[model samples]
Target: MNAQAKPSLLAKFGDRYAVDPNKMFETLKATAFKQRDGSAPSNEQMMALLVVADQYRLNPFTREIYAFPDKQNGIVPVVGVDGWSRIINGHPEFDGMEFRYSDALVTPPGASAPSHEWVECVMYRKDRGRPIVVREYLDEVYRAPFKEGMKGPWQTHTKRFLRHKAMIQCARLAFGFVGIFDEDEAGRIAEQSERDMGAAQVVREQAKALPACPEEQIEKYAAVVESGQRPAEQIISMLQTRYELTPGQRSALLEVATTQGDQA
Candidate 1:
């Protein structure tokens, strides 16, 4: 067998970027080459870079930088650090990037929401002499409205808030992953814990009176409480579903629930 060769980034990308000569020639006939005229690169070029960068899982900002299209041949070729810094430092404005959609492409009816969504495909620009994916160009278009909010570290905070909310939701979901607990046992523990603190007998009496609710409803009630809603009805529903408890069981459950709260 032949010796193995070290893999370069391009080698890794391989056929993903390989262009078809016939298609490239056809694309060149459709659009004019204007890169050298100091005009900004087209949306098509910008989008190709965006799609490629996403495939590589690069930083979002770095991905955004790829949005700038080189004007030379309408092929937004990746310009190394020098081209990247020029845009970042405000030396030259990277303009002319825009997003567009084609209506001819169709999916099965009702498969998804009826909205104009971006589709990814490699496009050839005669000016650039290479095939760039068109999806990145579309991303640049959708991203234009939020350009102002993206400057500096604002995007970082946005990402952090999303991550924080996701973590909280995950934590809440984790409670259900463990085996369900018996409300009667939970109440007894609460009563004993309260009693250990030398609480009044009324508290123990209340704990014994509380109603038992289903675990799912308890989770919903917790959410309702967190949302600042009085979840009394939800609690009642839980009591009905979990324990098949009559009004008396609910009253008892409430009393015990209050005792448990006091212990907490």
Candidate 2:
């Protein structure tokens, strides 16, 4: 007899949105994302993407939401402009929105085109007492061309990008949308996080290469713990950077610190 195929996590919805989760995943695997290495998104990645899509009621088949690999071996859910528009306007309490543009234009440090000084978005919610307003400055939000000198939408459609930034910020404040990011913002954050994690790993490897703590130094630390001059955790962390500590040494230090702390 043949084994049964397990249903996808999205199967719980049972076509409520008229989407077959497993079929959609199979289709998206071939089309949604074009990786740098020409690889398709993994099943796990597709599942994660679907979860976020379901949460926000976005249609991945229409490219409303997509996935990007994150530093911590997870996915960053990136929403399209249309997706943002749908979510904001679809909110039950969303009353209306208005935009304000700056009179002056200025070119940012790295931008290829000049943009308005700022754009502001004011979003009103029927349930709220006051409207939520957010201002985005072109100079601050402008994205420069890639290192290869290729210009992105920010450089080509400066005003639109500025307006989008303002609207997204305003919506976040008004609606409390969390864990979703714009494409550019998601890329930058993921890359920066990966770099930070890589640096942290290097530091950890260097710390692990350090010599074991000397018996005399360990005794000195135990004495300090007994005296309650410094926190046990703090001293242990400091010592860890310079030397490897055994479990027994850590336990002994904790015991001494506990004894001293109890007496006080």
Candidate 3:
């Protein structure tokens, strides 16, 4: 028998993560390529992911970079906060980055109520005469006029998400990753801005009214998933394709999946 060849990053990833690297990367590349130009993942595309994995130490199996559903069944690959940190901190050409958040208890005289919720990011490069600066505001992203009962990063995770938004935008300004973005941020903006910026209130109210899932459904979903006859993706794809689950239900199902997976 021929000696086994050394593992590429792809194969090594299989040992590092519980996920099947082949399937995980396959789905990711398919989604990444579809976002690129509406085409399937070519060998070149898969190689590109390998290069990226090395460059940023991202783990596809763990969703360091992931695919988010976009328009027309296409998908957008989003880099998580950890991935963003790796890219920025590992860049050889940069002196490093700096971020600052406003801490005033009250908003400026002309600014919106309560506080100035924003962050500023500065990317310092030795070759450049000056640092690249980017400042993003919660209001610029979440268009809802400042009022009570709004569901947004401003209320939910203001400082953290603010810094996140600013850092990602700053990364774009410092080194443009074409066709790549923190789509999770876009999703948050969409959620808070939908229906003339009123969806948040309705969503929260609806969430309060909805009862928990039937215990039998959770048990069954968990059992089938833990059995390993059908991979997690199979269950996820079937649910998304065959049934229309509300956001709350989807979240509940995901929680069950996580709990059961951990136990197994």
Every model: Cα RMSD to truth: 24.5, 6.2, 21.4
Model 1: per-residue Cα lDDT over 1-264, one tens digit each: 989986543343332346453443233223322233445345465345434543433332332223222222333323223332233233132222222444543222222222233433332333444433334222222212224434322133323222222322222232221211122222334445656556566666666766555556555555554454554555666555435455654564455556555676
Model 3 steric clash pairs: none
lDDT of each: 0.37, 0.83, 0.63
Error of 2 at 35 (Å): 3.9
The digit string of per-residue lDDT tens for model 3 on 96-211 reads 88987777543332333454467799998777889999988766754342455545445554556667888888888887655555755646534444553466677666757655
Best-to-worst order by lDDT is 2, 3, 1
After superposition, the stretches of candidate 1 with alpha carbons farther than 4 Å from their true spots are 1-3, 6-8, 11-14, 17-66, 69-264
Each model's TM-score?
A: 0.15, 0.71, 0.49
Q: Mind giving the per-residue lDDT tens digits that candidate 2 earns over 1-264?
A: 989986655675447556776665566777775354567777777777778887889877677887777777667889999999999999999999999999999976555667899999999999989899899998777777776567678877888889999999898999999888998888898889989999999998897799988889879988888887887898899998888999988888888888987899
Lowest lDDT sum, 10 consecutive residues, model 1, at 175-184
Candidate 3: misplaced stretches above 4 Å? 1-57, 102-117, 143-154, 185-264
Q: Which candidate is the best by lDDT?
A: 2
Q: For candidate 2, what is the lDDT?
A: 0.83
